[model samples]
Target: MAPLALLVAAFLAYSVPPYLTFDPALSRVPAPPGFAAHYGFLVAHILFGTIAIVGVILQIWPWLRRTHPVVHRRVGRVYVFAGAIPSALMALVIAPFSSFGPAAAGLNVVAALLWLGSTIAGWRAIRQRRYADHRKWMVRSFAMAMNTLLSRVYAPLAFLGLGPSYPKLGELIPAASTLAGTMSMLTLLLLSQWWLDRKPKKPAIAR
Candidate 1:
């Protein structure tokens, strides 16, 4: 997970600078004409989502959780209120106008809703002192939040896998990207469940 997180951080370092620059010329996907607020929403979503990812790393660290439970709880609040909720809300606002196509838009919408919903569920569970449920739901929330990184990871792989066989690569890229997002969500969901069900190995007895 550390290596994967470092890789994602590297990807963000490379990919996020243009958006931060606030120059439309550097925008990866320009705001559709007539929707002036789209760029603002996109930037907000990116920033908050980045925060949520960082929070996840710290929240899940065994040393932090074990040694500093109070800090963990405080960070959890920030992750919920300052990061995931805002990012997911902004995602809802922007997803319908996706440049890729309606399919991509729909996928984004679903992912955002699930991300928002799972995070909320986790928060509620913790509030009610249902620690087990909280962990499960938070795992799901993390998986949903990670869709951003996973989708980006999948896009290039999809291109490489499909480029040679498909004659009209340009036309297919949008659909392929949507498929990649779908696959990312599904893959992450499965992994999250596996995590939830995993049991710690018992220590071997000394003979």
Candidate 2:
């Protein structure tokens, strides 16, 4: 977890600075048409996404949860209310205007909804004192939040891998983008379920 967190932090360091500049020229991808405030929502999504990812790192740290439970709960509240929910709402707003095309836009919408729903479920689980359910749902929520990282990783790979083989760069971009986002989110979701369901090995019998 520590290593993975470090990797995500590194990626965030690399990807987040340009957005912070708030210059339209510095936009990572071309802003889609028909939206006057696309850049504003993009920045908001990035900002809240960063907070949510950081919250996941802190929340999942066993040492933090064991040693500083109060901190864990407080951070969880911030994550659900301030980080995950707002970021997802922004995603819903911006996804439809995705420059990547209709397929990517639809996928983004689904991902945002899943992220939002899982987060709300996690919050409700904790409030209801269903610790087991809370853990499952929160882990799932973290996986959804992590689409930010995986999307970046996959997008370039999708371009490079598919670009040379395809003749038309324009036509390929949207397909690659859709494929990348879908694979990234799906991979995380499957992994999270596996992590949640895995059985611990039993101890050896005493002599």
Candidate 3:
């Protein structure tokens, strides 16, 4: 039930933005110069973000997680390939457009790269039968994957914290959201690694 709720929330969060006709904050900030040429890039972001959310749902659901490892692997491969790669590409293209300037751009770029690197490393670890390493890398990858959702979570919080009269509250929201989401993911990843490390190692049985 929790996972279903999270999935629904993620979908609505991603889907609602493009349809918004007017936003005071968005209107105040000039669109990034050359936004016209890169409209397709934004489309790519929406596409990959949607795919990643679907991938996560498949990954976390118990019945799907346990009952169909092969199918999961296949889906995961598509998810990584489609979601991670294009997402990273779109991130690069859009990073310069961030109203928060270079620092925010750097963080966005790093986050995207981390997402790609962790995913690839996780795949490699699985192929090498290093399940521990695979799990760790995957945890990191998922952390990066969750950034999309985290950004949304942070925006409202930032708005509330800074108050309505705060100068540039709109601009600050996206940047703060990214930072908060990244930190949250990092904390969760560290805790997951610690828990996994403490578990008893399974003996390697002959196939």
Least well predicted 10-residue stretch by lDDT in candidate 1: 162-171
Q: Which stretches of candidate 1 lie over 4 Å from their true place?
A: none
Query: What would you estimate as the lDDT of candidate 3?
Result: 0.68
Q: Pick the candidate with the highest lDDT.
A: 2
TM-score of each: 0.93, 0.94, 0.74
- Model 3 misplaced regions, further than 4 Å: 8-31, 168-207
| C-alpha lDDT score of every prediction, in listed order | 0.89, 0.90, 0.68
The 10-residue segment with the lowest total lDDT in model 3: 21-30
Give model 1 RMSD, 1 decimal: 1.8
Model 3, span 63-156: residue lDDT tens:
8768999888888887778877677678777767866666666677777888878888988998899987987887777777777566556657
lDDT of residue 106 for candidate 3: 67
The TM-score of predicted model 3 comes to 0.74
